[model samples]
Target: MRVTSLLVATGVLLCSAPAAVAGPAVRIHDVQGTTRVSPLVGQRVTGVPGVVTGVRGFGSARGFWFQDPEPDGDPRTSEGLFVFTGEQTPAVAVGDVVAVDGTVTEHYPTAPEETPETTANQSVTQLVDATWQVTGRGAVPAEVVGPDSVPEEHAPLDGNIDKRELEPQRFALDHYESREGMLLRVDDARVVGPTDAYRALWVTSKPGQHANSRGGTTYTGYADPNSGRLKVESLADGPFPAADVGDLLRGSTEGPLDYTSYGGYVLEATRLGEHQPGGLQPESSRPQGEDELAIATYNVENLAPGDDPAKLDRLAEGVVEHLASPDVVALEEVQDNSGPVDDGVVAADETLGELTDAIAAAGGPRYLWRQIDPQDGADGGQPGGNIRVAFLYNPARVSFVDRPGGDATTPVHPVERLGGVGLSASPGRIDPGNEAWRDSRKPLVGEFLFRGRTVLVVANHFGSKGGDQPLHGRFQPPERGSEVQREQQAQAVRAFVDEALAIDERARVVVLGDLNDHGFSPAVQRLTAGGALVPLADSLPPLERYSYVYEGNAQQLDHVLATPSLRADYDVVHVNAEFADQVSDHDPQVARFTVR
Candidate 1:
């Protein structure tokens, strides 16, 4: 791994340091004999000093990494260096070089010839137990210079950087490669809206690392909007910043961003001109009323109640008071159980029972939730609390209709039964075929009547963190792999919408959930563009119109789109960060509308 070479070099330096005779340090040769030794294992030497090259804050405190540039042939190999943790500290940037005096300790060793890409190696590098102090300070050069300097291959155009927006994951990969090891300048970054922790800023830089299999190469000298600084990571010492966010980044050109990759990297951003404070305003100038229905969606930050029914009751009350108070609420990451599974529990009494009970207890209306039941035979969660998408609605405002051929007594897709017991029986099953159950997350659809008009509501939760493998076998290219499962979920909802439209051209429809894909993603676009379901907030500006924020940018992955007729009366009000902070990881988007 890249870090191994650095660490080996550091060991050599530490072993040879004591022999250096004091003076204006000149080139030192191997104080030790000429025989190469196996890399040091678990040596705990202390108080070596080096410059701070990088700093990362993972919420609570700042973590520092740096390099001690050694003279040529000093027996000190330039492999991995040291990292220290500082708690609740003031922020530190890239260019502000500080001397870190820490012990030379053995990092967890990797197996022979092991690659850095695997989880074992990744975890080992992040483990930090060493302690160090800031001994001295030096200012980094104002300009960056090197072969690793930002490349021109993927540079944004002269006047269009803000005109394009790429999907979140793809954008992260591209940005990572472009600025992996470069100095950068950022300006005027502020922690605005909701929580002060979420900082935003404009970035300027040359591109860095080249693209590799996992993703793009790290850009060496680009600015980070979130951290508000230029970044770098190197063995000689680094992960440093050239500038802070929100500062006027000079010597930069703006242009349209491009992301034409296969994992659907598409975004449309309008350049609103020169950077200015309080940049934009809401496009709609209408007032709102309490009687108008407000709909919110959230990925409810792992809202699972363990096994206890009482715990579920507590959870239900919270859900009712905070989440379901509005007219319609679409929730993702909900779990249920037929019973206990191997790792622990697999039941979802808390999500279903608690949520429903909470709504009723609050003296609010009842909610009808539909999910893929895993009891009979449908696949359940791998360990437990087989989570699924569910919907809660006020019965007084809407009622379900019986279709001509619809099976009212049976669910649309009944859980398949196996061996006289449901598939929920064994939660700890590790067979590859059993893994297929992960792909069975189904979309829940229901029809409700609002003021004599029938509106279709579809709630969905797609596949989670399985990493980029094609869907097993449902569709072919043009129609591809497991990604097809996501498409099918969208297609299922569209089919329901088509059915609604077939019955009446003016039929109203609203589709919402944790789609996993952004508004511009192929899966979402297939459902919204070209006179399909109209985007509810298309008239609103992007920032004011998002339900989720990630990696310094806001995205509307959880959405509420309406059929043409429903669009006229509805307007969206995105709550401020204060309100969203209490709700979930995803802020709820409330859509208020009047029934004509």
Candidate 2:
């Protein structure tokens, strides 16, 4: 009793000192507990035993992950831990048995500028202000993560999932939380998302589920985030493959399960699998017929004159060959002459002139463009690069009805002329003064004549889903705060479309661009609320509906809608989103409509 009391007293004294001596051992599983957040968070845990699994010696987040060689029987509690060594290169090697003493912490990843303060991300359980000493050496035995090991259910049906007890045998997110910091393996993983600049690639453990024809998982709805999708990053900093969708990571890819702002629950692989090419190719759409009006929408991903010549060439190539030279193109993210430089320039004439010139140079038609310059720094996008939407029309196929009196704040109203509906000001802004356009790109409404039939086009670059909580956030049904602004933006566009329809029942109005929200979302629902327009993408084959790829799930963000009069036929050109070498993150969409 006396010896135990003296040792305990000595340990308390050492806890305050810089140095720590091993005293009274605790299990790593106990420190992890069974909840999404560590129960022992903010409490000092002494002598937690683990074998060093991996180390991240670079960047602001320098840390080492270790796992207990002998894991506890309960699958609910994790047997591994991460010791955050802020900015210091940790001197530790894999396979070393060590005893750690530190405060158990629940670390949440967030960027306050984008993500709202109310929303919460899944907290990573870690050991901070830690002191550790090597006790011995051991080999890291990784547990296999596959269809059998990973459950079908992604998370519980409904509720705040953070406080819920982990059910590794059932929920996929729970399974990942249960194995946090633990070494895991995936055999013959199928690539769903291409390898990004950060050397991270996404793969699916369970294949043939929610599978798209292009060897990727389609994120069709919010109900299922695709439980099979797993993110992998190489820890060795060695030569890793830049894989595309439908490729294969051939054998035994082993790593420690980690959580970060770099997409939740990543597998930092110490051993990367052999890269196997899947030979996936891009799909091209056939050109529109002589009578059909092909109007395509492409988000040229913040294109500026100063960008890489190859990128501009690739975009031009996609426009000319892949998209089959549409009569009218709605281009988004067209930055000013000085791309991303914070010099207060808002004009994008040089940018568009270069692109139109590029298309002409690429054996395409001589397309002319028209757009209004947005207020400097008022639109939300890359700082200083005032990104806005513009229209590019091939003068040979269609003629612009230049009504010329539109500015950033001037609203364009539909006026009746010659038994047809015409805009009060062609190439006008839609209700720009409304609060809906706050820090958002205002919709550009333009009037064009295709073979004597007038067509009204609304080029929109709505509020982005930038600040929404991630799908795997701490809160179930993660908060989509960005939707509120987008919904309002949708209503404003709908109101403008309604006005045109009210003036003339058959307005020939085409509301198209990067709507930023899914077709089933509330923002999109508001767009088609009164049956004023119908989404052309909805008419596509189930597997072929996607225009964007996010986290291995091929989804839709760009949309094309028209009044009931002009039923449109749409094709999502799969040139960029599926490939590792992409000109833009979004794929160009070509919608063909026949005018009376």
Q: Which structure among the candidates has the greatest TM-score?
A: 2
Per-residue lDDT over 1-596 for candidate 1, one digit per residue giving the tens place of the 0 to 100 score: 01111124333211121222222211101111111111222233344444444554444423543434443432222222325343432234443333322222222223232342221211111213343334346532212322333233332222222223222122332242222111222222221222222222223232222211111121221232221112211121222122221222233221112111211111111111223233222122233354455555556545554445554443344445444355666677676544334444445555666667766776656776544344322433344555656666666655554333221123232112321111111111112132323455555555555666545566666554244421111011122244555665566566656655665666556677777665666567778856758766566544345554433234456677777776443433333222212335454554665544
Q: What is the C-alpha lDDT of each candidate?
A: 0.39, 0.86
For residue 561, model 2's alpha carbon misses the true position, in angstroms, by 0.8
Model 2 lDDT tens row, 308-363: 88888888899999999999999999999898998989999999998988898999
The reply for model 1, stretches above 4 Å from the true place, is: 1-113, 116-188, 192-296, 306-324, 337-350, 359-372, 375-382, 401-440, 465-484, 568-583, 593-596
